[model samples]
Target: MEMQNITLSLPKPILHRVKILAVQRQSSVSRLLTQAVEKMLEEETEYEMARRRQMALLAKGFNLGFRKPASRDEIHER
Candidate 1:
């Protein structure tokens, strides 16, 4: 994978906290930032997929609510 470098500025207080975290974890600030970004991206992708699935099903008039036991079993069988 290609790598790019960019500069970011953090508030003095936040940067101080990051330094403590980096020392505890024995990781560099950049590494911690990268890991944080990766985790957030994974969650975002999951949210997007779920949203699309909901839209598609709702387009077919599926109400995302509880139903009586009989109606629930009927939909599951199909």
Candidate 2:
């Protein structure tokens, strides 16, 4: 994979905290940020994929109206 350089401006306090965290974890700030971004992107991708699948399934055949509606007896049994 190709590497890209990214520069971010952060508050001094936040930067100090990040440095402490990096030291405790024994990881560079760049690696930590990269990992965090990758994780969030992966999670967002899954959410998008799931939403698309749900929309597609709904479009094919989904009923908003009730069919063979359950009676109060059915709900009370559980």
Candidate 3:
């Protein structure tokens, strides 16, 4: 796969924390950021797919072998 380079401007405190995390994990900041981005994209894709499936099911509707009550009092009856 082809790779591209991009520059980001972050606050000083945030950059410091990212650098510390990189050192603790023994990985480059670039690699850590890439993994984070990949995970976020994957989660978003999964959410969209699940939402579509749910919408389809809703459109199809369900049959529980149920019928409407004969009277409103029957529904409210305890």
Candidate 4:
């Protein structure tokens, strides 16, 4: 894969915490951020696929096997 470098700015306190966390995990901050972004994109793609499937099912509708509509009087009869 081709790699492109970009600049990012973060608050000092947050950066400091991230640095510590990276060290504890034995990883670099860049690697941690990359993993987080990858996870977010994966989840978004999965959500979109599920949404499309549900929409298709709704559009296709379902069959309840009823041949004809019942009269209102029949429905209301005790």
Candidate 5:
């Protein structure tokens, strides 16, 4: 895949932490950032897909082909 370069500005403390994480994980900060962004996008996409599916199910509604039961007072004498 083709790759491009971009610039980002992060606080020194955050950058230091990212650098430490990179060392611990044996990965570069660039790769870590890429993975983070990819994961965020994937989660958002999955959430949207689930939301749309739920909405579709709601639109279709549910039916058991049975009449609803009567109220408690109707079924039992007080």
Candidate 6:
């Protein structure tokens, strides 16, 4: 894949912590951030797909197996 470099700015404290985390993980900060962003996008895509499927199911509706509507009296029968 082709990659383009971009500049980013972060607070000193956060950058310091991220550097420590990168060392602990044996990875560079750039790689760590890339993985995190990729994971976030993947989750967002999955959630959107699930939401569309559920919405389609709702739009299609369901069959309750009733030939005719029941009267309120029948429903409230003693």
For all predicted structures, in order, the TM-scores are 0.74, 0.72, 0.80, 0.77, 0.76, 0.78
Total backbone collisions for each predicted model: 0, 0, 0, 0, 0, 0
List the candidate numbers ranked by TM-score, top first. 3, 6, 4, 5, 1, 2
Those runs of model 1 whose alpha carbons end farther than 4 Å from true positions after fitting are: 63-78
13 Cα displacement, candidate 6 (Å): 1.6
Stretches of candidate 3 off by over 4 Å are 68-78
In model 2, state the lDDT of residue 18.
88
- Tens-digit per-residue lDDT, 1-78, candidate 4: 787888999999999999999999999999988888999999999999999999999999989786887899989999
Root-mean-square deviation of each candidate, in angstroms? 9.8, 8.5, 5.2, 3.7, 4.6, 4.1
Q: Which one wins by TM-score: 2 or 4?
A: 4
How well does model 5 score by local distance difference test?
0.96
Whole-model Cα lDDT per candidate? 0.90, 0.91, 0.95, 0.94, 0.96, 0.95
Top lDDT: which candidate number? 5
1-78, model 1: which lDDT tens digit per residue? 676899999999999999899999999988899889999999999999999999988888856696666767787895
In the range 1-78, model 3's lDDT, one tens digit per residue, is: 687999999999999999999999999999999999999999999999999999999999999799876798887889
Q: Please give the TM-score that candidate 5 achieves against the real structure.
A: 0.76
Better of 1 and 5 by TM-score: 5
Q: Once model 3 is optimally superposed onto the true structure by TM-score, how far is the C-alpha of residue 21 displaced, in angstroms? A: 0.3
Model 4 lDDT-worst window of ten: 62-71
lDDT (C-alpha) at residue 63 in model 5:
90
Per-residue error for 78 in candidate 4, Å, reads 19
